[model samples]
Target chain A: MNRMRIGDLTERAGVTQRTVRYYESIGLLPSGEREGNGHHYYTEETVARLQKIDQLKKVGLSLEEIRDVIELYFTDTSEVLPKRKVLGILYRHLADTDQKLEALGQFRSDLQSNIERFERWLEANERD
Target chain B: MNRMRIGDLTERAGVTQRTVRYYESIGLLPSGEREGNGHHYYTEETVARLQKIDQLKKVGLSLEEIRDVIELYFTDTSEVLPKRKVLGILYRHLADTDQKLEALGQFRSDLQSNIERFERWLEANERD
Candidate 1:
């Protein structure tokens, strides 16, 4: 198993070292091994975990929610029941994302209408 | 010329008093009148300004950019040329909003694809 220092892990994961430490502090990430020189070392699995964290954040999961998802990923993989349970969680997340997209669409329309109002003001001012 | 205290202004504008004070501290809003006991009093204009700030925030304008817009609203209305200049600024903001909507649309698609992947995994696991 290839191991990496904290710096290397942060660089490979495209997250700041401070963010990685914060995640660990919040229990969103696992603690790493301490070397003889007091440096931390992590396995390649840390990289994969960080990537998953980034993906979950992009999908709008809070750290607490991501922790829940991570727990689901690790617990009881010997049966199909866990996968079915995960499907239900994912479906709820899907609905949340859809709601977010709907809100964004509404904001976009508001911006358009405001722009039109400003344009009309400009046009009327130009005539005066 | 009806005057209101900070609390009244915030209540009418649907923002917290702290937010109104922060806007004043940041120079995005003018400082209010100070009473004999040192309480701040504001006019109805503060209410309109807070509403404008809220609308600009919804459209994703930074405080600095919103300050610029506010300046444009206040400055040099004697000529149509200033209105034209403001139109240019608003056009740039329109482009930025469009870009944000595009990125949000992309994220929505990614969420949909992830949901499909989870559904497939659930189906495969159920068969086993």
Candidate 2:
């Protein structure tokens, strides 16, 4: 299979070329091989790695944490148990996200009530 | 009516004294009167002001924007109409927050699917 260019990899991953370069610079992604034309070429695995990074980011892992996890996934001697431990981390992240969502929901409800109160005050003042 | 100390204000507001001081430093809150003993004293209006700040913050307005809004509320020549306009800005913020929440929800579902896929891979590997 032909190696994909950086642009192609970014398009396939649904992320901007800038984001791809940033990921590479931060070591969250491997640097692509440079061709004689100064263009970077990525292997098929690049897309999967990008997807994993995106998944971890969505679950609120910092780039550093995601990098550590990726390194662990690749270099760890023990695979199954380590993977299970990573799953536990993901579970905790999910729970933390749920709690944040709940807090935001409460904030939203409070704001709605405040808005209603303001409206009522406006109406009451108009009557007076 | 007797004036309250900073601690009392924070306790009543369900926020920390440090947060209150931080708010004051940022000019989102007004500095209280300094007594001879160096303690700050707050009038009942301080509680109302803190509540207003909390309400704006709940709607995700930045401290700077909240300060501008508060200044406009207090000093603007035109009152009712400007208050209505501020409410419009708040409505837009609410919509933006709702969109973010929906996007986060979609990300959560996608992560859940990825986790299941990873689990299936583990099961398949164990079988082999």
Clashing pairs in 2: none
TM-score of each: 0.57, 0.60
lDDT of each: 0.73, 0.71
lDDT of 2 by residue, B1-128 (tens): 45999878887777889888998999887889997888899877788788877766654567887775565334432454565776676576567667656655765675475467567767877854
- Evaluated at residue B104, the lDDT of candidate 1 is 49
| Candidate 1 per-residue lDDT over residues A19-90, each given as its tens digit | 999999999988898868888889888888898787666555679888866654444534544556766776
Please name the candidate that would achieve the greatest DockQ relative to the true structure.
Answer: 1
lDDT of 2 by residue, A1-128 (tens): 35999778888889999999999899888889997888899977888888877866654567997775565334442453466666676666567567656655765675576567667767877853
Off by over 4 Å in 2: A1-20, A42-61, A65-81, A120-128, B1-20, B41-81, B118-128
> lDDT winner among the candidates?
1
Clashing pairs in 1: none
- Estimate, for each residue in B1-128, the C-alpha lDDT of model 1 and write its tens digit: 46998878888999998888888889999889887898888988778878877766654567988876665444453454455666677677667666666654665575566567667766776757
